[model samples]
Target chain A: MSIGLKKARAVIRATLSKGREMGLSPLSVVVLDPGGHVVAFEREDGAAPGRFAIAHGKAFGAVMLGMPGSAQMARAEGQAYFMGAMNGLFGGQVVPVPGGVLMRDGRGRLAGAVGVTGDTSENDAEAAVAGVEAAKLVAEA
Target chain B: MSIGLKKARAVIRATLSKGREMGLSPLSVVVLDPGGHVVAFEREDGAAPGRFAIAHGKAFGAVMLGMPGSAQMARAEGQAYFMGAMNGLFGGQVVPVPGGVLMRDGRGRLAGAVGVTGDTSENDAEAAVAGVEAAKLVAEA
Candidate 1:
């Protein structure tokens, strides 16, 4: 089953609201389908200019690589040349950050991913997980 | 005067609904903020593989160039070299096509842009304009 845009937007909204409640800096959130296509995206007011791009990249990476951003970073460890080549091939769409989290359906099928940017990477990942949970989906970080 | 995600999503939904009513093929729509950042995006099921990227590129071009995609295509006529250079400079983020349209607020300020893909260019542009109108915004094309 595919993740619909409504669900994606719900995830994004939940993530941004959680970020705000935590008194974090402004955030940008992006949700991508399993095919690495954007389902929903939002940049909160006062977010930095580059936040949206970074958020999108993280989410795209998670979906395209079939791994959470943190795990991707871990796998890319000590492989700077490989990472560089991957980035070059994908036009820098892969971000090795902690903000990307994979989503799965109740049947353990891949749904998509959510990415958040702004504040610390850990906090961003936390918010993304919170969003997936809020959407009643499983977040695989 | 930036277009918020809520409004952008509304526009996208309206466009998709209209496309459905018209019996058009599955579509992918994208909305970009004034700064050329994605505000919202959606791809209907069954949409062709590259539709999302094409929709995004068209919307980004509209917002960054301050004109509709059709106009951009017109201006690019007899300027293949310039258009090529621009695409190279922007990393292929710009698409000169008929489906991209500019959005303006009631106060005549630049708001954002909407782009549609997966149908005839004329139908795509029509759907985009209908979406902006449904949102009570101006569609400049």
Candidate 2:
């Protein structure tokens, strides 16, 4: 309930628009409550297979770790060793795409997350960010 | 709980011990409840920054979909669709890693998940499997 379903849908709409604006191909986007539960998601046509999942996967990595996927690269030698262990844990459901949104309530506690995949990681991230702005949620600063 | 902390830890310890036994570098491991919450986690001395979270993210994807990351490759065509829809269902906590463990209770109920990243994805998965087997839990058929 951090961001209402109405807003969640709006974010998706905005994300799609952003994807179009960026000239990225089809994309997948997801929004999650702060506790990291799904609230809404959308996958546009023509995205790569696993593209949607990877976006969600990367976003999961970002939101749960409380940062962005780009930043995770610096956490170690990079995401290989780090990513390897994670694959073992979840049985290999981790995709490293960028572009996810974290939602906060009006009071500004972390409320949920949004992740998008398809196109470059950075482009995907831009779409998610645009969605968050449309929803009026701030990233945890 | 599919793999309780006690068992999960045993799996982690054994996995790590095996890694050292095999001359693999230090690894980070995470076990998540069926619902994809952290049950137990271990970060070896050299784990890269945020590697642990990434592993968890991918593993989350595997557990949510009941498939291996490799399986996702087959479904890449539908991947965008999956991600778009699933991220919201999982609240943005799942990732589609290449290899991870799916913790299941007897009688085929999902208990939780295990993700490891450090060595190779296959090696990380092998270690997780060893841990799950050590914990006396059954993998899905």
**DockQ values per model:** 0.48, 0.06
Q: What is the interface RMSD of each candidate, in Å?
A: 2.2, 9.3
Worst 10 residues of 1 chain B by lDDT: B40-49
Q: Candidate 2, residues A16-69: lDDT per residue as tens digits?
A: 998898888898888765555577878887776776567677666655555555
lDDT of 1 by residue, A14-91 (tens): 998899889899888888888877766777767776876799888888887788988877878877677667777788
The sequence of per-residue lDDT tens digits that candidate 2 reaches over residues B13-69 is 987887787777668888878877788888887454456765676577777788755
Cα lDDT for residue B74, candidate 1: 81
Best by lDDT: 1
